[model samples]
Target: MHTSSTNNDQTTELDALLQILTTQVASLQASYRTSNTTERIPSLLKLKNLETLGPDSDPSLNETRRLIVSAATQLIHTVQSPIEIVQDYAGSTFKTVALGFVVDVNIPEVIRDLGGEKGMHVDDISVHVGIDTSYIARVLRYLATRHVFKELTPNVFAHNRISILLCKRRSFEEIKADPISRFDDAPFAAHVHMFSDEILIETLSAFSEFLKQKDLSSESVKDGNPEDTSASGPQSSAGLGPRTAFNLKFNTSKSFWEWIAQPGAKYEDLARTVAVVMRGGDKMVDEGQLVNAITTAASGTPIDSSTTDITNLLPLVVDVGGSSGSATFTIKNKVLQDVSGIKYVVQDLERPIDSARKFWAENDPRAIETRQVELLVHDFFTSQPPSCQNASIYILRMIIHDWADGEAKKILKRLREAAYPPLPLSTQAVSPEPKTGPRSKLIVFDTLARYTCDDPRENLNRSGKEGSTSVPWPLLGNLGVAGEGFSTMMDLGTMVALDGKERTRDDFEQLGKETGWKLESVKPGKLAAFIFSAF
Candidate 1:
């Protein structure tokens, strides 16, 4: 009994010692952790503070600690997500800039307003643009988030440096004084109707139907016999596959150019709207420095020679698919002014020519008398004429995205053929040593399919619709799928009216490659965003 008791005591003592050692080690570990955590608290807090404060806060270190604290407080704000607030502010500003397009509804007047470095304010802007105050303010608010305007308080806005390139500045009075021709104000904005409207919906719906049918088009076969290759062929027949069936059933009598050329059409609204948007900041050639920038960017060559005589060097310039000749008008005024033998050819359709002629005749008799530009009715999908062969340049301004791959290829092929015509029988052997160089370049000015530079402010203006103040979320989402300015209302009209659709940059390039044209480079600007050069 004594031995057992002694053993029990010893076991109890050993357990107590083990517990004490464990307690000491745990205490040491906790102390170390607490010390380490205390050391890092300030750093973690400092990192958490950066989310606060305005993006343009002073960088001076005099009040660095105070600034950090302030930033933390602002960063922790729960009223609105910082991103949301910024986006809203940007949207407000973008709306303001974009609404200008809708308000002015007059291209020349808009350009005239933007001729100088200092742009007009909302109130003064309203007077020039003929838009109401309340609506303009709302639009400006949305544009603000996008940084389209520096809201120097409510009802006032100062244009940004980059905003000055949206449009080519022009004298409204001069445009008014000149003949109101079709080319003078072709409905440029209205062209976006196809992508925004019924055509896209219909196309996608058809695609969905195709997918449902195991990747087969849902149209009925034309012939009763299974052996009839016409059922599977790429030919058009009534009640056939989607491509062929739609080709025949959905046949449009009037081409897009023809439809827009209709006398007294609503293109006037589009013209005036684009004019206002352009003039908002896109000052015309009046700013010689801006012109030089554009010239350098467009030409992709150094302008080193002081007396290169830019005008005389350009002989025959073809404005391919130059709707209403807005780009041509700007370029001619800016670059080709001194070139004596310069002749501008604006190609579209007989319909565009008729209105363009009327517009030219009514507006600028001297311009017409000088014969600076000749309107040519031509489809870009067909063969390019000899007159345009090896021309000094062919400028396709905002034209390439109007069709799908197949149609775009046809257009590109036409241009490519023009650049490199078939060797004649007589000159086949002596074909100028095979040229051994890239020539007859193609200039394209248009929007990218779904890409844009990060300017929360400018994006709103570029994508917003006329009359509405709210930023378009749906349109933004659909930019990659459809386009930025898409409208179902416009698509139905296009199908019944214009027979055209918008395309993406990828679509354009893919089509270009199929047509033996190589994409050389792309110059992205503020207004249209991208200019593609093809060889």
Candidate 2:
């Protein structure tokens, strides 16, 4: 009787999940119909045009997607045996390794050139990549099973929608001609390679052992010698200590940035990958939403034709540590295109500032020629230069997540001091009050971490703000594995690589309060904008 009852309960839960899946599918179909597209699942042959759909681009579609993925994943968990599930996860590393191997060997480009959609046999692919036919078949089969590539026939593979994205657009010959610069035009491919390559994979491998050690604190980790503490064994870069899993794996005392700066083909390739990845940060938030966030924080309202003149109110925007000025360029082109008298500055280390000069020279030479945009070399750890002290807005995109809480606070404090500079002691008797001007705004564009379980505090904190999504019952609050997967993965990746983290709403609030700023509002999207005002 107890066994029968247990089976019945399991059936009931499965039924609930199926119902959720069915409902979400219907919603997705309705969205497709509204956009005048076929109400069928997107084709595997090509990328979907959901982004171009007018009204169908609403948050409802994303919500439905979240529900469908969550329900389906939960159903799989319900039916799959524990041992099977564990094995599937245990072998997951092979997926990354296989994907990386194919990408490194330029399999996607070769397949595209040799056999478009028709597919290529393992023998042909093996000849092109110089790998064993059987090995190529197995690796392709593994990826095909995961829906990364497609298996059209026995020992034959082709580029599916997912795999086709890895194409660098250059011909196979061209890529081979310039092997080192192959990823220069393919940022997405670079991003995948960075994660799956030896550096990140080896770093992640040390995570388990690294966590096992006592005193994983920053101080302890920084102080301990890698030679003495590394359980894996000693490394070539001896004398240096382990600050993170990356440090432990590589046996370097230098930070991720410092280590990457050293001269080497591998390090240079990794550096280029990181720079390319960072260039895509602006795409994380919608342009309109980002513009509104910055303008609203600058003035008391959003930008419009009849909006109050911001020339005298807020004259300049300083992008602190804004590598290559991509975000600054987005702002200049989108919001300040016609707003004359207002200036823009892109601040970074000397190397990035030099890159910024080249970037601006190509994109908008007039801005630099007219002195509308200035590239400045500055470090966030040091005091803000006198020129940037009175700037109206300071933008930090994907910057804060690169450091731990303590280091992150120092960066914030430096910006806070710049935004609200203390009154001069010599003029205390004459003008003692704080400088009278528009309250300087600090726009931190980064990921906002979400909890897997429902948290009432988030609901209260984001009461009237955007970026909050409702989770239906019977699913994890953050939509289980469907939603927040990338963010959580990034959280761990940052921790492994640089001892950094993604922050929750409470974390941002506390950081703001501690750094003499007030968290005014949050504009959430792929990368949430945390707008803070100097107190």
In lDDT terms, which candidate is top?
2
Task: Give the alpha carbon lDDT tens digit for every residue of 288-307 in model 1.
Answer: 33344345333632122243
Q: Which ten residues in a row have the lowest lDDT in candidate 2?
A: 231-240
Q: Which stretches of candidate 2 lie over 4 Å from their true place?
A: 1-12, 34-40, 47-60, 213-241, 301-314, 338-340, 421-437, 460-469
Query: Candidate 2: which pairs clash?
Result: none
* 341-381 per-residue lDDT for model 2 (tens digits): 66788988888888889999999999899988889888676
**Best candidate (score: TM-score):** 2
Cα lDDT, all candidates: 0.43, 0.73
